[model samples]
Target: MLNIADTLHRWCREERPFALATVVKVRGSAPLPVGTSVAVDEDGNAVGSISGGCVEGAVYELCRQVLDDRGAPQRARFGYSDDDAFAVGLTCGGELDVLVQRVDPGTRPYLATALADVVEGRPAAVAQVVEGPEELLGGMLCVDAAGGIRHGPLTGVLRREVGAQAWSLLRAGRTARAEVGGDAETCPERLSVLVHVHASRPRMLIFGAVDFAAALSQAGRFLGYQVTVCDARPVFATAARFPHADEIVVDWPHRYLEQAEVDTRTAVCVLTHDAKFDIPLLRLALGLPVGYVGAMGSRRTHDERLRLLSEAGVPEGQLARLRSPIGLDLGARTPEETAISITAEIVSRTNRATGLPLSALAGPIHAGTSS
Candidate 1:
């Protein structure tokens, strides 16, 4: 899987054979969503995880069976029951549908390419036929951001249809299952494919090389974001100050944001707390369709900033998108705590969460719109 891209690349370079077990479908309170995978080598070495540790042992055995049999990929389902709490079921009372397939250096050459693209931060997607004819089981199709099929097995109408579906999922940064072929009423044996989007790391643009920026950069990296720290002052925006940041740009915040590539997954954190930078930069950020746009400041500063933004012709709706005071009400007093608060707010916003404690929630802790 893309999560273990580095390890997968190493295995490919070493010509090592491995079995990949992917969670293609999940139900109930599953810990991981579809597309999460774990790889086990012939030597019993493992990388990644499909479950949080509940069904891993059984999945590992399934991986070994795939390598030993050298046959068509197999699917296994694991779930929790009232009587099977201590068995191979998830402690969280969830269910998982796992697909185990052996991958060899000679047979799956596209895997190496996919792993490389993931490591290099390129957008890609892996489309696998999880349910189909025995011979087609585990068959793979790979596509990149440019609508190019790096490798695949389908052809003609089927290929085009599947590629279009994969491209759509890739752009949305979502993993999902798609059905192809004739209508159920007219024909049977419809193909079921899982499109696993390997999107590049989401961007986190932190405008201001302050202490909070340094901590936020580290937190962003930990959360798998490509963090950029920007400031107009060259002395403040140095690599030494924000080592975890992917880039340190010494430029005006508004100018840089105008030229930066931001998507629905991107998060912008305005930590400069200066009117000159915050006013102009926020005007642009609020108008863009980014995932999050938060500015750090006190209550008084927030009111002043809003007044200036309103006077600058920013629409009321766009101004409402700004999360002034930046983070959640965690009563954070230190840079590290503030960074955690900010990242937590970003996560909550992106996931459409209520920012409530798990204990207070009645449903699954990781609940979200299923894909």
Candidate 2:
């Protein structure tokens, strides 16, 4: 799994055989999402986690069994049990369908190639046959960012179909499952393939090196963002001040952002409250195709900011995209609390969530994904 890519890559380099248990499907409120995995080395050591703590012991034992059985692949289903309180299952009342497969460099060469791509920050995806014919059970297909198949077993139309799906998943940076085959040329029956997307972490560009920015940088990094704190003042934007930031750039915020490679997955936070710094940076960030563009200020400052940007020729629609208050209404006053609120808003906007508590909703607790 990409979450533990570094550990897995290390194991591969050592030529150590291990069993990987990945959550391929979930039926209900799972704490962790699909593609979360737990790996166990041949020496009875383990790394990574499937569930936060719910069914790890069971999955670890499953990994041990796979190693003892000489790298045989297996499937396991875990759910809450009403009969036995000590049963190995999820306490959150969810079901996890786990696929345990052995990764041996001598046999599965594609595992190494896929893990290498992930560790090196190259966009890639590994399509594993989760449910299908007996012989094709644990087959894997590795696809790169350019829709090129680095390794796989399927050929002809089936290979093309799987490769296309893998490319789609990689572009979206999502780990999902798709059904392929069920044709004369491909396969008579439908086969389910779990595409484990290994995309680089998205970028979180925070302008202004204030205390709030420092707290936000730490929160963004925890949320899996490659955070960069940029400012025009070199005195404030130092590594010692923002130790959690991946990068600290002492440049004009707008000038630095003009050349940044931003995409729909990037989040641009304008924390500089000054009129000179805020106006130009927001003018550019608002027009760009980014996931979120938020600014920090009071109600009066927010109104003035909107007027300035409107006068600067920014469209009304684009101005609406700016989250002037920068965070949800969490009544937060401290820097750390504000950081939590800001990152919460970013996640809610990214996931298209309602920002409402689960108690107010009636459906599934966790968001649904293709499986």
Q: What C-alpha lDDT values do all the predictions have?
A: 0.88, 0.89
What TM-score would every model get versus the actual structure? Answer: 0.89, 0.86
Q: Compared with the true structure, what per-residue lDDT tens digits does model 1 show for residues 242-341?
A: 9999999999999999999999999999999999999999999999989999999999999999999999999999988999899999999999999999
lDDT of 2 by residue, 1-371 (tens): 77798888888888998888999899878889988889999998999988899999889998999888874589999999999989988888888999998878667677788889898989889998889987787788889878889766777788888888999989888888889988887889889998999887899999999999999999999999999999999999999999999999999999999999888899999888899999999999999999999999999999999999999999999998998789999999998999999999999999888999889997668756424
Against the true structure, whose lDDT is highest? 2
Cand. 1 TM to true fold: 0.89
lDDT of 1 at 174: 77
**Residue pairs with backbone atoms closer than 3 Å in model 2 (clashes):** none
Off by over 4 Å in 1: 10-17, 41-46, 133-135, 183-189, 369-371
